[model samples]
Target: MLTINNLSVHYGGIHALKGINLEVPQNKIVTLIGANGAGKSSTLKSIMGLAKASGGSIKFNGEDIVNKPTTNMVSKGLVLVPEGRRVFSNLTVEENLFLGAYLRKNKEEITKDLNWVYELFPRLKERVWQKAGTLSGGEQQMLAVGRALMSKPKLLMMDEPSLGLAPLIVKDIFGIIKEIHRNGMTILLIEQNAKAALEVADYGYVLETGSITLEGPGKELMVNDEVQKAYLGEHK
Candidate 1:
């Protein structure tokens, strides 16, 4: 659903991306796995126009969306759940969730999507009226994902959803990712947790520094010697 071709980015003198090429096909989960500062987040940011693209094109569906306004992403059926769960601390949980659908005027559909989000995350439902800052980290992450879903996007891009969380909660988050994929949500996932990300991805890319080093079927990449040695923490 999204295609990035020869995309590059620069922040002053630092060339953060080196003409990386990637694609997220319809109804498929694609992952970019790399270490910190590997330009994984830059790729997503460029797509969302959060970071400026220094060169090349980003095609959503079929049209080029390289430098479009970030505000238009949702209406085009694209959404991003950023690396940090940036929930509104002062807003109640329900208020934060409703804010996700603020762009839309379909009140009934918004309410329906809100209930679905609550169902997907029962904890958020339980804390519906509570201050967002009071929720645990995992709950905040769920809130972020749930908020993104409120837009009813065709393509969902998530950056580092499992960062700084407990292993069990990470597992739960991956399970939720799988569940969302099973229901046909196209996902472009950026993760440092290669094992979990690749295990869930339909396809995977290994990014190094600022370029794509390897791309393959998710299971194939999982067993690749280079992937194992570097990202998967396996010797030999």
Candidate 2:
């Protein structure tokens, strides 16, 4: 469970996010969808402490984590699979996955999680010894998500997981997302593909110019007139 209230972020004089309020309940997928420069990624970065928040509160469970260090956030079971699938290019798939569990000392549990991740991503299992950079874009994205899962996150925050992949691969990725949620992982997803994101999300929010403009059930928002016209590319 996560809560963000009155969240604001600024870069020099440029206001990036303004008083954004949102929540991710336990075992649910909450999506934030918007066009470029809408501050969707900034919200996730602020929660992970990657972006400095000028003011506001980011609370995971019950504690305030507005300005907490990124490492601290990871330890608290909050993890981010950033946009662009920033994988360690030179590292082998196995090595990349092991790095995700860097904070944990329990070898047995880490091994178990490694197996689980492999199961979740069979392609990574096949390419266990291959360099991450050599993998296809879809494989690299899978590696990114698999690496994040290795950390055993409580609330997984993913930014644009479907970016740049083929349509079929995007569909596969979203399917995996739904499976992840079905397995009881709470997700805060920021996606540019509104149709795909809303289809998998339980609740969805529309962010515009650094603020929340619409919030509703994912299905409801999917059929909304404005959402249809703007994000879904449908005209009434």
Candidate 3:
């Protein structure tokens, strides 16, 4: 569904990403995991065109999207629910959701997506009239994901969907992610929660200091000696 080749990014003198070559197959959940400064988020931002890439290419659905404007990417069905749950503070939950479908021309299609969002997160449904600022962190996270889904993206790129949520809430969110994948939407997930992310991912990449150091099947990554020691926290 997505392919990135020799992707590199720089911020002033800092190399945020170094020649990242990666591929995400159709209709599957692919995750990139690493420590705090491992360029995981930078890769996602590059895909969204939020961050300018110094070099390389990003392709989606067989078309080259490298250097495409973020708005153009949205129009082309690539949406990013960024790291933080950045919902509109003053807007009602329903209003926030409505804005997500702004790119959709059909009212009926927008309404259908709204209904699906509510079904996916009943709490959002219950608080439809409430202001998004009033939602708890976990609830807001769901709202963020719901808002992204409102864009009706074919490939949803989620960055740290479980950043600061409670364990139970993380489980709920991951379950929703799995459900979304089951329903045929592809996902490119960048997460720090390696354990949970790998559990649901079909494939995984281990990124360190702006480069991919390991790549394998998700289950294999879970048990790799170096991966287990550096990422999984295994003593052996």
Which candidate leads the pack in lDDT?
2
**Candidate 1 local lDDT, 1-236, one digit each (tens):** 79999999999999989999998999999999999999999999999989999999999989999989998877898899988889899999999898888788899999999988887899999998999999999999999999999988899999999999999999999999999988889999999999999999999999998999999999999999999999888865
Listed in order, each prediction's TM-score against the native is: 0.98, 0.98, 0.98
Clashing pairs in 2: none
Over 4 Å off in model 1, which ranges?
Answer: none
Residue-wise lDDT of candidate 2 within 72-190, one digit each (tens)?
Answer: 99999999999999999999999999999989999999999998888888999999999999999999999999999989999999999999999999999999998898888999999
Task: Report RMSD (Å) for each prediction in the order shown.
Answer: 0.8, 0.8, 0.9
Error of 3 at 199 (Å): 0.4
Cα lDDT computed for each candidate against the true fold? 0.93, 0.94, 0.93
| Per-residue lDDT over 1-236 for candidate 3, one digit per residue giving the tens place of the 0 to 100 score | 89999999999999999999999999989999999999999999899998999999998988999888899999999989989988998999999998888788999999999999999999999999999999999999999999999999989999999999999999999999999999999999999999999999999999999999999999999888988888778864
Backbone clashes under 3 angstroms, per model: 0, 0, 0
Clash list (residue pairs), candidate 3: none
